[model samples]
Target: MLPSGTFVLGGAASGKSAWAESFCESSDLTLNYLATGQARDAEMDQRIKIHKDRRNDRWQTIEAPFDLAPALAALDGDSIVLIDCATMWLSNHMLAETDLAAAQDDLLLALQSCAAKWVMVSNEVGHGVVPDNALARQFRDAQGRLNIALAAHADLAVLVTAGLPLTLKGTLP
Candidate 1:
């Protein structure tokens, strides 16, 4: 059985992904990488390639940028899921002009029903300045709200800063 669920949050390039990976590697359960990022630009494509290269062949990589609920539902209980970053997922949804409320509902519902060990990644966006556009503002607000909700439900909520993981909600065993 899965030990528990966690949310690994951080700013850009804060080593959240690496730390979360280490946490998962330390476990004996089967690993599944649920990638939330998409190759939209040359830079993102390179980044995605780098991440893919870093992961071992033992892990099954699933690219689900928007509707992760379905992916989570399809997962077996014995596997561990690592959602690279919620920032990208939210960006994908916002770029598609998706229904934020319904999307969030689906996302949370997926998490609730997931049986495997899940380590979700999210960016800490509220510490930044206000956006100039309405859509940007809406995205920032939604990200903050979504992070808060996810953190509250997570068994372990950690903030990664300067490559350091700080426990904010739960203890690391």
Candidate 2:
């Protein structure tokens, strides 16, 4: 059976994905890598490639840059699914100018109902200096709210920084 959900929060290049991968690796189940990123530019393409290169061939990757709920729902059995970010997923919705509230609700519902073990990764975007632009500020606020909502429902919530993990809720398995 899948264990209760886990939420891992951190900043960019802060080893959150690596940590989440490790958490998934701890289990004997097959690893399902649910990539939320979209390589819309050169930098993002490189970043996505780097992440892909780090993962072993055993992982099955699903590129659900916009449809996370359906992606989660479609997966069968008890494989461990690592969603390598909530922020990117949110960004996709924001950029598409979709209904943020409805998207959030759908994402949460999928997480709650998925049969597989899930280790969700999200960026902690609100701890730094406030964004000077309205769009940036809006994104930061949305990210924070998304993290909180996920953490609230997660059985284990961890904050990672400088490649170290600090558990916020439940013991690390």
Candidate 3:
């Protein structure tokens, strides 16, 4: 059985999203996709399309590139939301010069109070070499903090590597 909250962490192309999606699909709740990615370029557009193509009509896609709290708040207990890739969401806020601390607080609060089951997918960027620039380093630090918060809040926390899941917190359902 899927828990109320699950945090899925992985590197790029680690199959974390696929694993998260499959976990949600196993549940009986209505699937809700809270997409945080924006198509800023051709490659990004194709990436978004691929994600969309993977999800069928059963998923109710909600495009939330900047503000996710509203969409997350609207879900009911009968829904299971997949917040695909929080890395992009964080980047969107960072690039926009938004108050990241405030934004992260709001997101955590929303997730805490949400009535629906949720599986958040985030990139595990801390496993790589140190970034050469300030911005990259800042993003890495922020993502690490965010992932820690999410994992602390989640009932089940998993790290996906080489398309395999390794439970970090709770038992895998």
Clashes of each: 0, 0, 0
Per-residue lDDT of model 2, residues 1-173, tens digit only: 33579999998889999989987887788899999999999999999999999999789999898878888888766688999889899999999999998989988999999988788999998878988999999999888888889999999999999989999998877
| Residue-level lDDT tens digits of model 3 in 1-173 | 78989999999999999999999998889999999999999999999998999987889999999988889899999999999978999999999999989999999899999999999999988877898999999999999999999999999999999999999999998
Off by over 4 Å in 1: 1-3
Quality of model 2 by C-alpha lDDT: 0.89
Candidate 1 residue-wise lDDT, 1-173, digit = tens: 33468999999888888888888887787888999888878999998888889888778899898899888988887788999888899899889989988988788778888988789999987777777888888888999988988897788898999999888987887
The lDDT values for all models are 0.86, 0.89, 0.93
Root-mean-square deviation of candidate 2: 1.3
Highest lDDT scorer:
3
Weakest ten-residue segment in model 2 by summed lDDT = 1-10
**How good is model 3 by TM-score?**
0.98
Between prediction 2 and prediction 3, which has the larger TM-score? Answer: 3
